[model samples]
Target: MKLSLVIPCYNESANLPLLLDRCMALDSGSDIEVILVDNGSTDKSLEVLSKLLPRYSNCRTVRVETNQGYGFGILSGLRAARGDIMGWTHADMQTDPQDARKGLELFDRHGDGIFVKGRRYGRPIMDVVFTVGMSAFETLLLARSMWDINAQPTMFSRRFFETWQSPPHDFSLDLYAYYQAKIHGLKVHRFPVRFGERAHGVSHWNVNWAAKWKFIRRTVDFSLQLKKSMMVVNI
Candidate 1:
């Protein structure tokens, strides 16, 4: 089966070249395409991408004229994807692209009704705090358990996307995606993966109470809808 890797990039010109090189080095067979979604970067990201596109035969870049948030870029890339299995990773290269092969292997074995998600390690203090808090809130809201909901390098079959509908065009998309998977009774296998600090850029989260509350509300709403849908399906 073919694999599509979606990378959402925002002002990531400094890291794109190295990220692309590492991604291209992965041994995920020959049927892999890397889709780089530029989220209206003001930096030289597009110029750098243009220059490097010719060097990698399996890599393609698309530029969004306006900043459409993280999940919006993911949706755009998914719409453009042409593979049986699709997944996403950040452009910062914090998560190794080689780990993607492990996810693909899991998919190859149990992908018919499973979503392979990565569990992250080596986060900074603030990130650890944010992730732990978010995980607790998500578990409470969904009445289900998830490890590292914000982990990068999540892989899902194209069937999951086709069945669940389009994801939210906002930061809460991951929560919604996971909730949908659970409601549909899809098996989610979390694989341990290493996370590294950004080699060039800084993170955007401020890790305040407001962010936590916003995430909680979004997760609650998604969970309610998913529960109702699953009940109807069961009936």
Candidate 2:
């Protein structure tokens, strides 16, 4: 099956070269195409991709002129993807591209009725704690067993993706997808993957406690809205 992986990039020029190198080194023979979405980057990202396109056969790009949100960028690339299986991961290189390849392999075994994601390891303790707390909160709030909500290489078949109505345009996209997987009775399968420091540049939100607080507030607001929407659909 052809698998398309979307990397949502926002000012990730400093990290793209090495990221593309790692992605290209992956030998997944299932016609793996890496769609790098330029999420309104003002940096030299587009130019770098232009120069590097000839180096890899599986590399392509989708440009978003206005910076919307993390989910919006991936959605833009997903809409443009030409693969039977579609997935998305971060551009910061925290999660290895090989892990995404591994996620693709799971499709063969699990079939099209499963949703795959990485269960991250090797992150800082505080970050891990934050993720665990957020996951727990979402599980209870949404009445679904949510875990690793921000995990990478989230994947599903084209069949599953077509059922989405109005997905969020924010980081809450992760939450939306995972919850929808449970809501639709899809098997939520997760594989262990090591999380590492970014190859270049610091995190956009995971910097400090204050930033984490802001992220938490934003996410909680989105989660509430999503739950309300789901309730309306059920009614």
Top TM-score model: 2
Local error of candidate 2 at residue 20 (angstroms): 0.9
**RMSD (Å) per prediction:** 2.6, 1.3
Superposed by TM-score, candidate 1 places the C-alpha of residue 203 at a distance from the truth, in angstroms, of 1.4
| Tens-digit lDDT string for candidate 2 (45-70) | 98998998789888889999989988
Query: Backbone clashes per model, in order?
Result: 0, 0
Q: Which ten residues in a row have the lowest lDDT in candidate 2?
A: 22-31
Q: Candidates' lDDT values, in order? A: 0.80, 0.89
The segments of candidate 2 whose C-alpha lies over 4 angstroms from its true place after superposition are: 27-30
- Taking all chains together, each candidate's TM-score versus the true structure is 0.87, 0.96
lDDT over C-alpha atoms for residue 87 of model 2: 93
